[model samples]
Target: MSNPTLDLIRAHGSCRRYRPDDVSNEMIESIVEAGQRASTSSNMQAYSVVAVTDAAKRAELARLCGQQKHIAQAPVFLAWCADLARLDRACQLRELEQSSEHVENFLVAAVDAAIVAQNAALAAQSLGLGICYIGSIRNNPREVIQLLELPRLVFPVTGMTIGWPEKPPRTRPRLGLEAVLHRERYNPNQDEALLAYDREMAATGIYEGRQVEIPGRPGEMEAYGWLEHSARRVAQPMRTFLREVLEEQGFLLK
Candidate 1:
């Protein structure tokens, strides 16, 4: 029931601090090969990865991603892209009209990018490399597009920093299986599991001093947990310009 792969998967944790070391090109290619083995929608393979090691570019990327220092510290920064530009070329080769503007098409490409990136992540972990996924790559989408020289119909879905961990990474707790998994139909009544998880997470002190204060609320909270933190995140408007950016990238999202 237990194996190295499963152990690696369970041991997975995001590494923000990295030691100063270079990732070999051969190892990078091997990781990419693992990513390429991920399943794709209709074999369209609508994704691409840009591996950046240039010091200046990595600094700029770190700036674009809300100044995450790990990006600049890591030996390699990978920009995983949802790429339909190649699909457009394929249609041109066949002299056929391509339908890449639909929302469904965009979803397929985004999902493809995510799956491949996770495969690459696991591969890197297997090789004793640490990685941290940077969703803030979209903080300055247009600048990122320009910086990475991404063509139309190609969007950077996410980024990842890769290097040797400065120390052993800490594994964070996740919601209980009862909260996420249902037997058959979706179960809306999970308050019991939710409160239990809140207690479990509160004991870790991960959100200490980071509790969000909602406007119009009078008093400070006595207990802060995952639900409150997640609520604070969900309550805020994030990436509101993404629709416009997608349109500019040739994904009409119709």
Candidate 2:
């Protein structure tokens, strides 16, 4: 039940283990080429990527992600940056009154960076490489910027650590059709079916220790599930500084 494209994408999960196999410079160049081919916004291509393999740099990066060992161990880690700086410079040279100050331009560039990064991720997966998103790159944005030497108006949007998986994690169950895919306009809520789905998910052990970890949090339900896990995330201040950090990087620079 696998077509070429579907099978390729379905094969992706996350890789936290890797052998000592060193990825050659040629291979890294090819991977970058794969990513560069992704469609862009108005051909502006408002994104940049920095491939980090230096041991010292990787070590610093590990701490940025709360000491995630995979960051240091991965054969390659790519920092995907939303690069509005290049466009800004072009405007400066032309003495153009830059109007790209609104939040929409920043959002569009961020999406452009991500769409291309996903393309590279899928391509790597097809080549028997495993990739995991290191979303914590935003935890301390300026550190990442200084480490990568990103310019003004450019911000690190995300990180992708790639290597061969030492052991595969389960594909992880997704919310069933009725819960997610909606037709026509939209439904703000679907309570009963969602509860049933949550119950089924708990039986699958995905929420095994969730109740004990944050008893007062969202995922503390007797029927543990993904919703509970998501609740705990939003309950915290994890994403609180993103907008502020983006501002510091001159992202909304008018």
Candidate 3:
């Protein structure tokens, strides 16, 4: 019942509610250390983290993230930044030419930032903390950048709201193993597998009951099924707020 590994991976789930308890400063540092331990490309290790505890800042961040109230509710909001600025500035301080101005270096930093952030999330979950990634952070990157005082060569890849859970959440069912794993190849049988998985999801009644504010009919990521909710997501072209924000932040993905 106390497998540390399962505590890290298997039991990990996104939790939005909080009990008003604060995450201790030491725990926050440990969680950050876990993030720093994540593998990086070429050991480049290019990333920075901005921990936002200010209520006003979190409220604005919540607004930027599709107005998700949890962003504001959580006692801590960590913004994982893909930062080449620090490296560049260090280079400049030594009167050396900057090498990370290229697209490859930029992408490398961004990808590494995401990897590390997930590492932190899992670490928090293992330490009895709840976390929910706010991908909508990209919707208004300029504002976030300004609020965080990020430099030009740095970008906020994503934000996560973390806190103690108010109540435990049930485990959600996953698709059969065959649906995802491959045998030394990339072959996929999409139609049959998806159909079967959809039915299984429906039978669980995960999406049957929910209150959705979107223009379309009712949908639920919390309930009737994961498949139908995913269907609704792809049914209409979702906003590319991330793309817009990246461009605004000078992420010329050439």
lDDT of each: 0.92, 0.81, 0.80
Candidate achieving higher TM-score, 2 or 3? 2
Q: Across residues 201-248, which tens digit of lDDT does each residue of candidate 2 receive? A: 777886664453446676554655766766777888767777777788
lDDT of 3: 0.80
TM-score of each: 0.95, 0.89, 0.85
Better of 1 and 2 by lDDT: 1
Report the alpha-carbon TM-score of model 3 versus the true structure: 0.85
- Provide the lowest-lDDT 10-residue window in model 3: 214-223
Write the candidate numbers in order of decreasing TM-score.
Answer: 1, 2, 3
Model 1 C-alpha lDDT per residue in residues 76-128, reported as the tens digit of each score:
99999999999899899999978988999999999999999999999999999
Best by lDDT: 1
Please give the distance, in angstroms, between residue 116's alpha carbon in candidate 1 and its true position after superposition: 0.2
**Relative to the unseen true structure, what is the C-alpha lDDT of residue 121 in candidate 3, on a scale of 0 to 100?**
91
* Model 3 clashing-pair count: 8
Judged by lDDT against the true structure, how good is candidate 1?
A: 0.92
